[model samples]
Target: MSSSTLGYLARRAAQKERVRILYRRALKNTLDWAVHRHLFYCDADELRAKFDANKHVEDLDTIDRLINEAEASYEKWQHPDPYIVPWAPAGSKFTRNPAPPQGVEIVYNYGKEESD
Candidate 1:
């Protein structure tokens, strides 16, 4: 194939990957806003429908435009206070009790060291 054709194929592949990432992020963001399983399912279905509707587009320019619009929409509607797992990074309980530094030992039995 010609260099132009190769470049086009590469661009298309990148665009497809971006779309996949965007969809996943949007779905996860949706979960942050959904309080119940049924509600999450409904929202997920609607989000899937939106992506499916654009699945058949073959024009690169159109695909790029659609992706941009979808990203913008996602940004505008993202949850203000998203739900985060307590153990995950940036969560409330993350790194609450970090491991001690090297050369430091913690005695579990209270006063036993002094008594000994």
Candidate 2:
């Protein structure tokens, strides 16, 4: 095979790997939203269908464009922080049921005392 053919194959293989990674990340994120095995199956199927729907594109440019658009959509929609804001009301674990400790004393200030 010609060098150009080998280069094209290499680029295609890299793009395929990228798509697989994106799909897996999307499925894991779906689990975060689904919260149940059954729900996740349904979500995964829907995601699979979205990719399957575009399986017939012969043009490399279209495939690359679709992959990029899918990736952008994934990045735009997915939530980064699963946990609640640390300082927001009802957010922290301690805030859920805050109470005084059984026994404790302030041994030292968090910061050094000022000379003044």
Candidate 3:
């Protein structure tokens, strides 16, 4: 358990963590472009394949480089407009009361008649 060996292990662990975080972010970003469940499934599968193809590299230097490259590509191709939940406060459909169409009459008057 030399100091140098411990440092190497720590660095390797940090690199692996960075890669995992990057992969999760990339997958979430893919959801921005795929609205439907089927579309998201297909897109996610392709993204997984791309990541799996590079999973065998044991060299830390190459792993760091690959992570940097992936991050750059993700930034470049990020969706300009991502979908927001309709019920979320930031979404366009978020409202306590929606506006009615123009020229439509809304009546709130009620009359009750009782005859015996």
Candidate 4:
């Protein structure tokens, strides 16, 4: 291949990589938002117990609704949130620092902190 062709191919490859990374980051953010919202609005223990007792239909429906609401909220807030990375022109000088998944504090504090 000619030098110009090779350079073009390389640039295209780099652009594709950047696009893939952006897409993956967006998907991760969306999933994290949904999971956090679900946990926030639902009683996990009670839901689990109901599931174990074969009474999960209503709980499942409620969980679905909560997830939908959470997704809507995420979409609304994502544009303005610093934690969410916005799509920029290729080679732009922007750094992405996605927020960590929610509910992490509860897991980290499991039995470690005494309740008042």
Candidate 5:
């Protein structure tokens, strides 16, 4: 194989790794939010008692429903703003006026015009 082919494969692998990392992070964040919202506030001992009372049944339809609702709420909270503002402190050297990229060039157009 040529060096350029190897380089292309390497870049593709790196890109896939980055995408996997982002997906894992997003999943972790969602799960953390769901658990924190649903179970973290409740007393663990009480939860254990409830589980024991139910004989540790794996049929958690109710719990699943509650968790689904919590996940929806978490999604709402996560994307409150369409734009993500920087967390940099005021007057920080890195804190500059945040704006979208000046000009975004589309490398491979996907059945859409450049202006579109």
Candidate 6:
């Protein structure tokens, strides 16, 4: 009901969002290193366990500190060359074949006789 309570709620929501984003990024980064789906699933479980270990912490400062540490670790261990979809930006097939130039007309002939 009070302004302090509202501020606390907002901070908590923001922290939760940051944690969610961090978890997703970490999982996606893990995929870059695990070449096989089976291995990725195992790694994913381990990563989940690590996050679950800290899920019970109620201190906001502690949560913030953990988040910062996780982010730093993520940056340090990120893959140098992550896999990208062929059609995605920076991929080999990205924009490889662009559309034809504007005002260019393409005619399709179906059994039409040519007149000289």
> Each model's TM-score?
0.87, 0.66, 0.72, 0.32, 0.31, 0.88
Worst 10 residues of 1 by lDDT: 107-116
> Could you tell me the lDDT of residue 12 within candidate 1?
95
Which prediction has more favorable TM-score, 1 or 6? 6
Model with the higher TM-score, candidate 4 or 5: 4
The residue-by-residue lDDT of candidate 4 on 1-116, one tens digit each, is 99988976776566446444544444455444454766634544443343345333334345445445544644664534333334553323454554567865425675687779
Error of 3 at 96 (Å): 6.0
Cα lDDT tens digits for candidate 5, 44-80:
4443353346443333454345444544644565633
Candidate 2 clashes between residue pairs 3 or more apart in a chain or in different chains = none
Q: Which of the predicted structures, 2 or 6, would earn the higher TM-score when compared with the native?
A: 6
* Model 1: residue 102 alpha-carbon error in angstroms: 8.7
CA lDDT of each prediction against the hidden true structure:
0.95, 0.83, 0.89, 0.49, 0.48, 0.94
Ranking of all candidate structures by their lDDT, best first: 1, 6, 3, 2, 4, 5
How well does candidate 4 score on lDDT at residue 103?
A: 64
TM-score ranking from best candidate downward = 6, 1, 3, 2, 4, 5
Model 6 error, position 13 (Å): 0.4
- Return the lDDT, model 5, position 30: 44
Error of 1 at 114 (Å): 9.2
Q: How would you encode candidate 1's per-residue C-alpha lDDT over 17-51 as one tens digit per residue?
A: 99999999999999999999999999999999999
lDDT computed for candidate 6: 0.94
What TM-score should be assigned to candidate 4? 0.32
Best by TM-score: 6
Error of 5 at 45 (Å): 31
Writing each residue's lDDT as its tens digit, candidate 6 over 1-48 gives: 999999889999999999999999999999999999999999999999
lDDT measured at residue 97 in model 5 versus the true structure, 0 to 100: 51
Candidate 1 positional error at 47, Å: 0.2
lDDT of 5: 0.48
